[model samples]
Target: MNIKKHAVITTVIFALNAPVWAGEASFIAELASTTLPQQAPVVASISTSNTYFMTSAPFSANSSAAITHQPQPDPAITLPQLIEKDWWGALAEITVVLVIGELLYKTGEESMKEDFDYEIEGNTGRYFVDRIVTTESWKLDDNEVGMNWGHAYAGALYHQAFRNYNFNYYESMLGNFLTSGIWEVFAEYKEVVSINDQIVTTFGGSVLGESFFQLSEMLDTKEGWVPATFAGVFNPSKTLRGWFSDDTANRFDRQQSTDQFDIYTGALYSTKDTADISTTTMLLGVKASIDSVQGQYDALSATPSLVELDMELGISAEGIEDWQLSSSLFLGGYTQEVKPTTGSRESWGHNWFIGPSMGIEYSSLGQEDEEDFFAAINVIGLSAGGEWQNADFNISVRGDIFGDFSMVKPFASKDYQASGGQFWGTKSVLWEGGYAYGLGHTAKLTLKQATENCY
Candidate 1:
């Protein structure tokens, strides 16, 4: 109906017609081989007909008899089998991302070096060795907010490559981390190993990649060309393969399961207060959650888990902005229900969960901004929560303990600083109890302290 759909259909048709073309060639060759035996008879019959039709006519018999043979049906050709999970394709995708990223970085560096009249060292081997082998202290790099965010997105591309090949979630996450590490260690030989970039690329990218994956899956399940096109755009790796390879024909009718995942897009505005300055930030975010309960619920099934992924892009009127991502796989213990003469018996349930959460954040974009353009990663950390819900009331409490390893260039400092320490304890509680119209109140407290020279 539309250009995109038409394009997709055309590509599929072309792929399927490849075998048809080959078969047609074979059929023509077979007809030529069989024509030799019948050639004499055909010629004799044509001569007899000509003689019988023109008995007394003086006809110049220079005309040749044309043989009209009906085309034979083409035989079927066995198309090349499509591998469901192509490891080589995944590796090729990773290579492309790394190569292109490095090339872009080198180009930008060269342009800047020429403009600033600074000579950049060309000894890539030495640079790599110095950064990889030497025990150098962590120092903040000069990369700005855009660069850090781009690195994270690059990592997401790597994740998507593996995901496009049907890799599992954990495998895709591992690919993201490994690809980022490879880029940091080898691809950008001119730059030092960036601690912040690694954190942002690996963890933040995982959040972004997983969120995009879910959203794309959701879009793909919709029954419209617009949604399908958006789905392809959301997952560029899949789009590329679909357009360029026969994989599209193989997966044309593939369906995605939508019962286990929920995707939502929304906007929020919030204000943060620190000392004497208050900053209001507006964000556009997408959140996706996968509930394991959708498949099957077994009493002995090792603690049911829920995976949540969130990605946000925020900006302030004062020109401060950043990209933030977070993902957590929460594993819950046994569920218990209490039917205490409730108005709605179906709403009573109690659940407790505890799991590790990891994420990365990069902030501060303006050139003249006093804030630091830093990356912070919270590694696998513990988060525990309990919720009790009923028809008329709901109560929940949550606590998180995590640590952040950060590379930051403070506003007042001339150089970058590296810091890492435990976040100690953070807690929150929510209480809401109403039958017809629900009203709720929340309270939170956080205590965190970090020390310098943490490697």
Candidate 2:
């Protein structure tokens, strides 16, 4: 009986102390509010309907006061958010990606380096055992043009020559794949050079240090070869490129349940000696991408002879590994050609690319030790959209249905646009391939020994 009575008393006391616990929590919250100014209350006034400084004012409020309130907060953001926001964060991500890509390219390079590693055999042009992995193998007739178009001749010992290398590391840098590492580096030196009237080109060059640093993230990842979102900078060198480029983006975003919106603008300016006058271009854009693939429009206009509006419908799945597909119907009216207009000249055209694409990636292969790789294919007319590879070789093919996309001014504008307008609708094709031996594999004999023994 005594034990039961004691238990009941303890239970009653515990229940009575529950209010004390609540009181302690209230005290701590009040203390925190008082200590942190940023955490102070935001008192909204009835008459002004504006939120004002609440710290210096008295803590008294009338029962009939119509003021509302909320707590203020500290200004700092989390690290992950900061990383997604700052350019430095982007640099770090790119660096890590580059290092990995470099390693993968080297892995492939080593497997095939020996095929061409040995010296020439008997001074014959043919390499009996070109350890150089053949990325591409094929035959071309007169219809096809070699990457470099030039003439080659030879003299006894002394000769003078000149040649162009179409596809090399330097040229590759101008493309979308910035983190291509050695491929980029190799391309840099892939030029046809002439000596003694004979022209020769080899893929033995290295990438520039600056180029490597800029495209770091694209280095090691499977999708690293995709073009970066950033566009190329326009300069005097590209005055003849036919495309007007400016460093800017039209940005628009908004919060829900409000008509208010935010708009941001950007620009770039430069001057060159050959260029007679300095020009300032203003890019103005306003837009919002809707969740549904119905319709979206972005337009920009400023200065004389500059006006553009693009309307597009974009569709994207929201989830891990979800792919995005978009089609834009473009209508452009160029008040003046990218080049300054002289005499009454007007050019206007509308072009559209209806490209649909899908991609998938597997993180784990059945074999535990095997590395993960992704494969995707896209078709732009005759151009095979994605890249293809096996253990021994890799191939990438690209071609425009018509040569309309060609950067060079092939023919006269009147003649070309009239005749070449078909070229845009016509098709051009590009194919590239690479073959390499498996890792740690090597040929035991030199080219001379291998050739002699075969006979």
Tens-digit lDDT track of model 2 for 61-146: 12222222322321111111111123343344435434654575457665534323234456332332221222121111111122
Highest-lDDT candidate: 1
RMSD, model 1, all Cα superposed? Answer: 25.1
Q: Residue-wise lDDT of candidate 1 within 308-346, one digit each (tens)? A: 655566667754365555554433322222222234434
Q: What overall lDDT, based on C-alpha atoms, would model 2 receive against the true structure?
A: 0.20
Off by over 4 Å in 1: 1-85, 111-140, 222-234, 242-287, 293-343, 362-375, 391-394, 407-455
Error of 2 at 118 (Å): 13
Q: Candidate 1 at residue 57, lDDT?
A: 8
- Looking at model 2, residue 303 earns an lDDT score of 6
Q: Kindly report which residue pairs in candidate 1 clash with one another.
A: none
Residue 232 accuracy (lDDT) in model 1: 77
Cα error, residue 252 of model 1, in Å, equals 18
